[model samples]
Target: MNNPYNLVRKYDIMLKDFQTISTSFLVKQLPTATLFVDMKLRVVYASDKLISLFCDEKVNFVGQSLFTIFPELDSKWETVLKECLTGKSSPMGVQSFTDAEGKEKFYEWSNASWYDSDENIIGAIIQINDISLAIESDVALDKANILLKQQSELSKIGIWEYDLQKKTVYWCAMTKTIHEVALDYVPDIDKAIDFYKKGHSRNAISMAVFEATDKGRPWSLKLQIVTAKGNEKWVLAAGKPIFEKGKIARIMGTFQDINEEVVAEIKTKDNAKLLKTLIDHLPLNVFIKDRDSKKILVNKSECDYLGVANANELIGKTDFDVYPFETAKLSRDEDLQILETLKPILGKESISVKKDGSETVFLSSKIPLLDEDGHATGIVGISLDISDLKQKEQELRNLINVTSLQNKKLINFAHIVSHNLRSHSANFSMLLDFLVHEKDEEEKVKIVNMLTQASDNLLETLENLNEVVTLSTNTQAKKEKVNLHTKISEIQQNLSEIIQNNKLKIINKVSQNIDIRIVPAYLDSILMNFITNGVKYKHPDREPQLEFSTEVIKDYTVLSISDNGIGIDLEKYGSKLFGMYKTFHTNKDSRGIGLYITKNQVEAMHGKIEVESELGEGTKFKVFFK
Candidate 1:
């Protein structure tokens, strides 16, 4: 081992073997075109590929100068080659070139000084690689990636890559959009999972990742996640495991915005549930039948009506199973009419027999349920048992007829009584006149006064009866919009003389904007009667003060007339306050007809009259109108 001569000889043998092997591999089989040239730029070694490329069959290229081979190239190549000879390395670069025969080629080339056995720089080596197709393919791949990024953003689809080796996440531009995160946001595995909802979506994705990493599985799932902006979205997460060394090395997937689609699906399910709950709890018997006239749905009430234990028992059953053939046929005909006309059949009456063989009447409303294309898919029927309502309607009709007959008889009897009373009083007046002349002077004067009294009483009684008849007979008001303040002002002016004569002070507190629906003729009378009655019934102990005001309640406008007068002792005569010819006050002008007719007139205009009073204080009459 210490012998330098033997060491040198063994090293030389090994060096020669390496040279022979490397030279053969480079010259005959190396894919790259390589050449060696001396410091003077004359070719020393030329690979077969290089020689074939730069030299023609007629030219002996083994000793040819590189300048002659590429004479059209500039001095830049010489400078680079000379620099390589001086032990400077040339970086690889690509250039497009054309041969002398006008063919196009692309070359990636570099230069380095070749070494000999003595470790001294011998000459420069030139290496060239043809990358024409590779360059074109790289250009095409770049354009495709740009277009893909644009499309991903437009479609709201984001791509993500999970690197198992580095345990990091790559979020593409569209992934940022889906997450509503800033473009510059960086993500890790934990953070990405955190973006998913903290429950099912998170757990599912975690499991999916675990399965992919441990078992090399792929997964696609629709799930929900919370976004960076605090919005919740539905997304489709699909992952394909990329394997290296028989284990998952990466997972690539897509995140699609399925918010609209998922939300719509959720709403559809909610609506179906709501509809089911509503129909089941409703009291009305509801049923839906398909185009074949078979019941497809039934509510709880419909099931009970058909004597079935559950609603599902009635499914796919025809009405003939639940009712008589004739009745079922009639029902089917009505359903057909609804479908044919494509219109709802509202308030139709029909009868069916129950399981107990009892007849029941129904008021049914049916409509065709149409699909999106406007084709009728089925009929939805809603029915109510109207037996009791029909019975009550008949009773109401009979009562109305009886009341009408009685009213007519009462009117006739009143007219007859008036006629006989008028006739008798007329006879008494004539007789008294005859007797006044026939008797002596003293007797004649008494008889004449009696006759005049009889005549006056008869006329007063007739006039009151006429007023009552007129008030009672009219049912509807000849209505117009009557301003409360304007009418009150007009009534005050009309009764100005009496108001002044009686020392009555009228305070009209009603608003100018308060208006009511009332008969124009009746409005004046109503206000006048209230005022005159107030003035007439005023207690002698105080001055008559009348205040008119208006207030609005729910759905009604109220006009209140208050008086500080001798309010009637309501406990004594409240019931007769508005009674016919019932007078409680000692005032000579207190004809009970005034309040009675006021009541009738108020009612005819669809208004209500209510009074609040104290015996020695004041009476307030509030009229409520719509």
Candidate 2:
């Protein structure tokens, strides 16, 4: 086949006319870049625009192979040129390559295989149009689509589309996954419509579609739907009509699954309602104020206390609107302090002035309400009416002061009695000595017996006074971690003689690592008192057995002393078990002060003591310590 350039050369006889026509009409009028290639893919002709953009200098490019002129096109140039030379037409498609300046350029090119007069293939004409802007726009669009898909997946939302004209529905992959259906499921209009819940959802969507198509209106609504797996869900559906010549042609819309968010919103509303009900039923007056200190919400108790007819009347009102200026100012200041500090101010006293000019004192606890940012946005408070309790507390304080004065007088009187008893006992002993020296045998013997009984009575009174004084003193015991196993072992060794004499059996189950914070001396005294008491009150009919064990409860340790001996009737002596001078058994050694002292020691160390007993069954004393 002859090259098209050769034919054009034959037209060189009219080259000047052709050049004038090409420059005036063809070259100047073409908006696109144009080039002509011979069968060998050599550039035979190129527009002035193409020459200026690609070649720069026209003489450097003419008669050059197209690939040589633009070597960067080596990737796709051979295949495209071969197709064109063979008379096969290809659709216009985008091609990109870098220029001499290293800047990228994109073009959509279309080529036609030119033929000679004999209908044989010759050279080809190529038209090029710059599509860089369009390409960039398409790239941005693709990126946006990818980002949108990612965001939808992250938020657990899925989108769907439907075309009314084509009667076809399309679902994104996420949408199918949300409905628990297969990706290959081809949705029909009827099947898609049936997914909507029966009553309001179906009716609303039907109405929306009808209106969008019939009236060319747009609609957006939240509706419920049942998935293929029998799970209920919430969806946000929107639709708009596509018009052709002012007539509705198609309706398109998106469906988004918003089940989780919708359900959470509903639950939040329900919880708020329940909380309001609880606050209203509370005995204390509960109120909340906005940043401006205006009442935003108040419980029924507050409304009734302030003598307001309804809660609505309390809105936008401050305490000043309902109380005296002094009381209102005090309340407002407390609230302001709470807000400024962003902390709770508890047990502050305030007065509530009634509409009738009567006032009542209240113990109020106010706290700042913070937003998600940790900034205080308002205040919430509960005011407890404490007027009656306040009056009783004042009366008790007065009585205590009077009682303290009486106690001082009693201590002085007891000291005088002690002095008198000592002096009398001395005089009686001198009198008994005088009687013994008198040599009156019968009288001397009777006098000596009376002196002995008098001495015993005096000693008993002194011991009782000492016990009373110990009970009245407030002295805290020193605290340290005491290992239970070691302590028990030491106490058992100390009491080994008594244990052997009584043929007693002792069971120890205290763990070695079981340590508790307590006064070591006080613990030893407490344990001795418990063990001796058990032996002293042992059942006459059976051998004595005692169990010593320790366990931990919450933040404290419980050391239990259990005895299978004579047990007191807890129903009769429970309250007096730890009271001074209270004794259950009639044992001669029952001082009754042991339990009282043990209880005080435990309490001094911030601990507690309790007892459980059944007559003739056993007695257990549990001492709890830090």
Candidate 3:
């Protein structure tokens, strides 16, 4: 090891006439890695950068053999140096060396022999450049370009560049495809602008391009274009200007086909509008509440009943916001129950006292709105004004003078009205909701027909109410001994279509010899309700099944109907299972009045009914007759 300046002076006496200090300074400050080696192939004067770049710091290599400092270099280094000493400069060549950390690096070096003023060859000054970083950058740039090209193709994005100096336009392959033009189709600025739709689309694109080209600003717009094949499509056009000498010189941009997205968004908005119109036109008071019991949406009927000018006034408000404390609390409690259980509280009669102490009766149904995961996210509530029905009932009671016969008829008529109205109202709400959101024209027509049928049934029920109120007291009430097996068979035949459609197996296990003492109509109504319920709630994964069996216990004859269907949770809904307008399942057809009406009819005939069920397993209804 030697001081670099002293070592250089000792090796080349030709440098004595030169400023040794300046020569040492120039070599040390050289940006490029350089070394002066003698004809012996030993390092005579090494620049500071060369030493730091390739030689160990603690072991000075100014006087060391070049081979000793970089032994990893191959024997070709000797030939390169020997040629340089003979006045034949060596062309640039690459050498590879492994560092202490086992990382391989590349260096480019060229050798030219140095001489004194007399032109005598003294030593070789080698210039070396580290090219590892540049090589890595080149590899990374290649990968990025490949990835960008792949993405542009997949996204149907076309790139374009307009060079102002050349007055030429360049379009990528995808851009040409988007234009529905041949690959070799030359495009000018005017032709490209003409591709956009003639009206708003052309104007928008022209303005965007103007701003980008004239003001050096970037612009992105969604516009329509008519392709060469005459098909109109939506596209996203974006442009940026490249400036030269502080003035716009070129414009580069992308054109992306987004027809599918734009079309879908427009259709969705149309559907939403139609749905809102349907909901607002519904006759019943309908409102939807979020999980927190705040109203998210309300129909016109709900807003009118709540004394609001419009539905928007009622949105995001809870019952407490408009109703009295007691009324709001009651409604909130029912909402909480349905939300917690994810079950429906249907056809529940509620009485709200107004400020003037007058009562407004409403038949309200609240159904839990569930997400895909079956978790309740909100509740859809429908309430019907039944104050007029209540008034008629009171008038009938007053006119009948509280007589036992008349009261009995009144009770029966009342039950009929309650059951029928609840069923019709619930069906209306469900059908209307489906009709609103349904996109298929055929399905919507079917729903409309169903609504017409429901309307007819409701009108028939109203007519029946008037007729029943005038029934004579002399009308005899009697129970006949009906063949149980024959009755079940007749009912099954009536439900033949349902049975066939659902693949329901109605196993009538009742013995033909068995007979039951019951009113014929009561038995038919009771059997029909149970049979339909079995079919309506059948498990989706299993074939529908219903088995009717009869037995005699003590002095009572019992008929049991069982089905493999989605059953009730007795622990949660057992108490309200038979209550009017109480539905525990998510079946769209459930009105919660069938069981209530069935139970009432059974009791009217001096019969008792019992239900045994488990969620997801099935349900069985046993009716006992004396």
Candidate 4:
């Protein structure tokens, strides 16, 4: 052999040189950011891409050490490169570092040793790739998957898949929890269908699945189900068939727990039905309208007033459909105003004239209906029939007018009668004086005496008649604020002697603050008459007692005078108790003129008198002052 060792060495040297030249050219033509390094970790050749990534410009970096070009490279990279130079292994992995600009960068390196023709170890070749964007993308994808899982759990939504080919099913964690099953529980198509409730629910879900798998149709339904713990629940199940090569491959969808929402909706509907029933039976004419002023709801009373057979006849109808043109226009205008102002029009009197010339009066009220956001939606109206009341009020006014005219005429007649009686009494008295002066015989003297007594009685009657005329003429008495307590006290003082003589007990329980609108003189006279009557009608069995009190009822202040005395038999003499000169007692001072005059005084002041009495019980007289 000419020299076997020398030939082997020479061949190895030539192979190394050729490998260097070809690898350098290949590195320069690589697509990614790649570079080749020698056994000493020095850059042998670098691609245009690598130079642009690590260097500011395309400078000569062929002879520079890898660490010198990238000074921030750590010891982990050195160890990887040195082990790759052994030619026993090729290490490929990613490494990260902060570059000169303080930006994080990732490099994917594939390092291996180059060999000669004799298979001897040579320098290493490192293909470095800038994988920063790919690394960041992978990190973001992982975070997104974690967040989606969390959101699905919180929303009570679970994903599921059914594989037709494998005849198997997959349930996410939330799906298992919804079914009240163990996390590791495995399910099949048949088993999944069994979870649905019997009858309607099971049939619905079965049909849905059949359509989805057979016809590639999608289904979303709210159905009931029974859990592993035997609890009934409402769930929203949705699914779609996945097609592959024009054939159904699998079914994938979501499952959600919707029990609370469905139950709430059912309860709300029940409440609405109850409210409708209640409103329909109301007696007053109640109605609800939409924004367009069309009737949406009406009660039976409303239908009756509109001349409809039933409430259905008036549905979706406007006022113009039921009422005359003028009446409908006025009602519509009021509805529009309430809607615009969001205010209520309460207790408004409306008059509707019929075609036959009859009129009906109604007290109507309208209020604005608002939505949850406080925006006006429509109006609610109520009307009450007041025609009968109005008619009665008019009739009362007419009667009052007629009574007033008659009273005036009666007062004028009393004045004329009293004047004529007074003149006749004066002439008769003069004739009686002449007879007394002319009489001398016994029979003449006796006749003259009787005539003189008759004349005296006639004069007394005329004087009392004058008093009545004077009081009747003052029908229009001026009213002023009078304190009841003070007037009662003065009357008591004026009648103190009579009160003491009969040992009468007069209790003034009237409130000091009780004031009434009445003529001052009339109050004094009324109090004086009541007090005197209480003393005059003293009972023989016991001591006389009088109680005075007051109360305010509605618009009237009532003064009550009660007495424990000999009472009148109202059933026997009630009608004529207050008649002129009527007396119920045998007492010498028993005169019914007091009550008659008291009633006249009260009526003149626009007040009234009510009496309650029994045969043996006490009497209560209530004076109502307006």
Best by TM-score: 4
- Tens-place lDDT digits, model 2, residues 1-626: 99999888888858867764664467534666888778888876677777666666637565788877776664665787688889887744777878788989898878899786589988888888888888999999999999998988887666665676687778878878777789998887678778899999999988887888778889889999899999999988877887778777777666677898999999999999999999999989999998778999999999988877899999999988887788788778877888888879888887777657897889988889999999998998899999899889988886686478447636754774677577767868787777768677888887777787778867885776565466446455457887888998899899999989998888999888887777788889888888888799999999999998888799778989999988989899887787655788889988777887787678667678888888998899898986
Candidate 3 lDDT tens digits, 180-215: 999999999999999999999999888888878778
The deviation in Å at residue 61 for candidate 2 is 3.8
TM-score of each predicted structure versus truth: 0.39, 0.52, 0.53, 0.54
Residue-wise C-alpha lDDT for candidate 1, range 508-547, written one tens digit per residue: 9988888787888888888899889878889899889999
lDDT per model, in order? 0.84, 0.81, 0.84, 0.84
Better of 1 and 3 by TM-score: 3
The C-alpha stretches of model 1 lying farther than 4 A from their native spots are: 1-155, 267-276, 294-297, 307-311, 315-324, 354-358, 371-374, 391-626
- For model 3, name the residue pairs that clash: 346-581
**Candidate 4: where is the Cα deviation over 4 Å?**
1-23, 88-92, 96-107, 116-118, 130-137, 284-344, 350-626
| Candidate number with the higher TM-score (3 or 4) | 4
Tens digits of per-residue lDDT for model 4, 1-626: 67999999999999988987997788777887776677887877788777777786747978888888877666687887788788655656777877788998898878778665688766776677778899999999999988888888777899899999999999999999999999999999988999999999999999999999888899999999999999998999999999999999999999998888888888888998888788777767899999889999898788777677877888898888777788788889998898889989999998976544567898989999999999889899988889888989987896687488457647755665666577666767766676667646776677677777767866766675666666778877788998889889988999899989989898999999988889888888888888888888878899999999999888889999999988989998887776556788887887556787787778777778999998777899999998
Residue 124 local lDDT, model 2: 83
